[model samples]
Every structure is written in structure tokens, then in C-alpha cells.
Target: MGLIRKTLGTALAVAAGGAGYLTATTNLTTPLSADDELWSSRSFKRFNRHRNPSIQDVCWKSIPLSDVRPELRENEEALTMEFCRGAWAGYAYAPQRAIMSITNKGPKTENQLFDEQQLASSKYELGTRFSDHFEVVERTRNSVTLRGGGSPLEPGPREVDGLFVISAKLNRQAGTVDVGLKTVFFNSAEPTGKKPAPFFVELLHRYYARAMVDDGARRLTRKTP
Candidate 1:
């Protein structure tokens, strides 16, 4: 009886720890800045017309890139795109992707989702599509805006409901690059008493957003010599 009780206690402890981790948000994760360009975007403005408390959040993590291969480090565009690719891969191939595949709706492999030719070109221009669901709305030297138009849990016509702005901005002063992901939702059915999303929904979204940037930073570091 004691052994069974101990085992149950341990399991409960593990579950509590995981729940805490998922809900925790650090200083790097925060509400979107008031002056962010997305606010001025036509699509953003249109979707927000109803004054719904659509979620707008950002999370950032920095990784040193000074030791990266000279060719990549010197080419700002290349470095930025590399991080973007890594970040998108993290989102597209995370454990959630595997769970989604159980229903035979998700891509069997990464190759099925990404186009080799487009990835090779690494030219992220306006209207560029990734995985046939996310479309690029803007691309600057350090950041790219991707508008998601499909559901990961279901397959059908693309429908835009939100966007993400991923950035790899070099901080010369710190000899590091900040990889950031910002989420702006166009619509929501989730309840929001005084927040953009319910407490539990915000918690999960924050954790997921941070994980995407963290994965990208880790991938970039692995590429560094």
C-alpha cells in the first residue's frame, strides 16, 4: 500500500510541476507594444473593428551569434532567414505535429510540408507561403510577418485568423541576436473577462510561443562553429 501511495504522490508532483512550468511567464514574454506596426496594419485594424479583446503578445530570447560561421554571420539576411526557418520548423514539427498525425491529417514528414526550392531560395517576400497555410505579409532585414490561415487540427480552405511576427535582430552591443515571436489574433471565441484570453488559454499560448523562439535559438546555436 505504501509503494502504491508513493507512486501516486510522485505522479501528482510531476503533474503539478508541469502545470506550473506551462503557466509561468518570464520578463521576456509580455504584452505587445502599443506602437507596434501591426496595430496600423489594415488587416489588423479590420479584424479588431468589433473591439474584441483579441490576443496580442510577444516573447523573446537572445542567443550569441558572434561565433557563427563568418559567411552566415556577415550576411544579415541569411542569418535572419536561417533563424526563421528554424523557428517555423519548430512550430511545424513539434510534438503537437506528431499528435496531429495520429489522425492521418498531418504531413507524414517535413518534406511533405515545405518546398525544397523555396527553402533553398530563402527569399521571404510578401505573399510567400510556407506549408501552404502561412503567408508572408511583410519581410524586413531582421523580421518577417507570417499570417496563419489554417487549423492545425483540421484541413480545409485557408482562413486567416491571426499572424505572427518573428524577428532575429542583431544586438551588436551585446554580441547576441534576439529571436522574438509576436502573436496577434484576428478573432476569438474564448472568454475574456478583462484579458485578451482566458487565464488558462493565455498560459498555454505563452508557453507555446516561448518554446518556438527557444527552439529557433537552440537550432541557431547548433549551427555556430
Candidate 2:
């Protein structure tokens, strides 16, 4: 089992630094749209237009309608909720809870940090807090945006603010539902032009973003018979 895991990880590293990685535990699919279209998406525009030194990334994976859980196949909103829930369970949040634990804080489970009922609902009010750091700043039928507060895993308002968005859209022509996970990080002050993040920081950021979208899509799909 250990040998198989290592070989698979090596294969994935070769396949998709620009492409993807896959395993029983994780899957990273190629982008669902062309580069031009993806970069021009509405969600992409939100950060690109306003923040000067901001780093923004959007990862997308398409799941065939037939592959999704039967109950959520036709419901974009529910699919979005499910994706949000699954993304929180990605590699990022485990350490988040652990760091908080050192201080005797944080929730025991991801569900407690991100309430199942709230995640499943379409009506998340602005300012709804999650964990000790994140809060819903925007929400719609098929999308929700969270803003981070001060925490060891997140920067405070004084330095930088973090935004994460999860969304699902039905692509009827393709007979698939596209799930998107986006993240933005930027200083809170006025525009200072484009300054890229440190190499390792950007690397880790992209990996985490992809893991989240992949994990979320996996949950929404059914195992093949």
C-alpha cells in the first residue's frame, strides 16, 4: 500500500503541476474551460480589478450530471453547499483546527466549524462566522464567499485579508456541473501594482486550492458500479 501511494504521488507530480493529481484520497482535474474564459470569469474579475498586489487563483472540475449524487444532480444550490462542506475538510483546515487547539480553541470537527445546516441552506447571512477566523461576506443561490479574520492560519485586517469562494454551475450543453473554488489574498491598502508572492508561498497556495476543489467534487459524485 505504501509503495503504491508513493508511485502514484510521483506520477501525479509529473502529470499536473500545470495539470493535476489523483488518488483514492484526492483528485485534481484539468480546468473545465479555456484559459481565456477562465481568467475572464466573473469570480476572477472580483479580485483582479480591485487589488493591486493580490494573488488570485481559480480551480475548476467538471462532474457529469449522471455522476453526481441523485438528490443533488438538479440542484445547483445544494451542490454548492456540498462542495463548500467538502472543501473545508481538505488538507488546509486540519492544521487550522490543530493550531487553534494549541491555544485551547477551535471546534472539534469541521462540521462544528462550518455548520452543516448553514452550509446546506441557501440563505447564509453576511457576517456569519465560521471557526474563529472565517465569516460569510457574500452568498448567492450557487455561491458563497468567506472572508478571513485574524488567526494563525489567516492574516488579520491590519496586514492582508483572505477571501475564498465556492460555487457550482450547471453546464447543460456538456451535461456536467462545474464546481469552482477560488481564493484571493491581498494587502488591505491601496493598489501598489503587481507584486507576486514568494515562490514557495504561491506553490503551497495553488496546491491547497486544487486539493479543495478536487475533494469537494469527489464528495458530490457517486462511485462507479
Which candidate has the top score in TM-score?
1
Residue 203 C-alpha lDDT in model 2 = 63
As a whole number from 0 to 100, the lDDT of residue 13 in candidate 1 is: 100
Q: Estimate each model's TM-score.
A: 0.68, 0.67
lDDT of 1 at 176: 71
Give candidate 2's whole-model lDDT: 0.64
List where candidate 1 sits over 4 angstroms from the true fold. Answer: 1-27, 46-51, 67-69, 91-93, 99-125, 128-133, 149-160, 188-197
The candidate that wins on lDDT is 2
Residue-wise lDDT of candidate 1 within 27-57, one digit each (tens)? Answer: 3445677788878876565445544555678
Each prediction's number of clashing residue pairs? 0, 2
> Per-model C-alpha lDDT, please?
0.62, 0.64
Worst 10 residues of 1 by lDDT: 151-160
